[model samples]
Target: MKKEEKLEIKLNVQKESWKSLWLMARRYGMSPEKMLEQFVADLTCGAGSGGSDERDLAERWYYRSFEMMGEDTFVSYLCSDEDMIEEVMELKGRITKSEQYISEVKKRIETGERIFVHYGKADKKSLIAATWEELGYESREAWDKECEEEIREEKEIVSENEERLKEIWENFQRARASQSATYEEEMKKLDEFLEEYGKSFR
Candidate 1:
């Protein structure tokens, strides 16, 4: 056998499980460490569709698992490690502002201070009876203007978040590429070490 390069990973398991794994490893004529390495290799080894890389395959599995658990899988997959902190703070700020604005609007509605316009030729009594549209021209105009401004502000908020999300996804893609390149380099070095060891034994 060649002197293969070794990689170590730490896992937390119950004492009984560890004992069982050691027994199983001995039965297979290998150490527990080698057994665990083989297990991990078998679990992760597969050719993804359309020749996708390991990172993409791992991401797909992660997304599927989170979705099965009824979690916000899109948010989980969208933000890179670096983006999460900054983006979450920004989102929280936006949410706070939105909540305050909504509270103010609710207060105005409760106080009957918001404008409601009725343009039909109704008598004063009829106009007063109208539920939603019975305000004077000036009040109606003010309400319409306020609504338009609110809509524009809402759109701007959405657009900004959307752009930030796009940037986060781009950063994640680059990080994945970098990780994949590193993995390939490590594998190549391991293979070379194994080949040299085999030649030395011969």
Candidate 2:
């Protein structure tokens, strides 16, 4: 085997591209050189090829990060699965309805509209109502009590969604950790291969 020589290449990149690369390198806790080298190695060996499962996982992680960063204007990668897409659409519809309901309630409160509630035991029910009358009416308290259960349920729904988001974030973190571990193992293998190859020329 002939000895292989290492060559240094100087490449020009846009400032924004450089910044993005730097940020990604920092995100992975890697030096820019190692980060770029690994990316090239992965690309060359088709480890990050678009059709590969690993690439699909990486793409999902990419979109998930964007979603976490509030750039979720587009459909999520998870939505590619028919079942997941249906579930997400349902949740989104429910969330939209909840928001509209809350907004209407707030508008009604602001406009001093009357809110009515059924009070007393089931056998002795009476209709009670209240509004924000100018003479220091106690309608606000009544209104709050009237909607207390509903408000609590809404809060619980919001909390559940938040917990789900947190779970997704944790899953992404685990996936990222696994990818990093695999990358390190691949780098080690490449180093070993290069070392053996170098010795073959001696």
Decoy 2 TM-score against native:
0.35
The best candidate by lDDT is 1
Per-candidate RMSD vs. true structure? 19.5, 20.2
For each candidate in turn, the TM-score is 0.32, 0.35
Could you give candidate 1's per-residue lDDT for residues 54-163 as a string of tens digits? 44665676667765664222333333343564464455456557656666665554554443222445465655565444454356446656655775676577667656
Q: Model 2 segments beyond 4 Å from truth?
A: 1-76, 114-140, 176-202
Residue 182, model 1: lDDT of 40
lDDT of 2 at 12: 96
By TM-score, who's the top model here? Answer: 2
**lDDT of each residue in 1-202, candidate 2, tens digit only:** 8764654778899989988988889997987877766555444444334346545565666657765664221122343354643444445446657767666666555653333313223232122332245323466676565555566677677667645644544554454543333434443453454355446533
Q: What is the lDDT of residue 175 in candidate 1?
A: 49
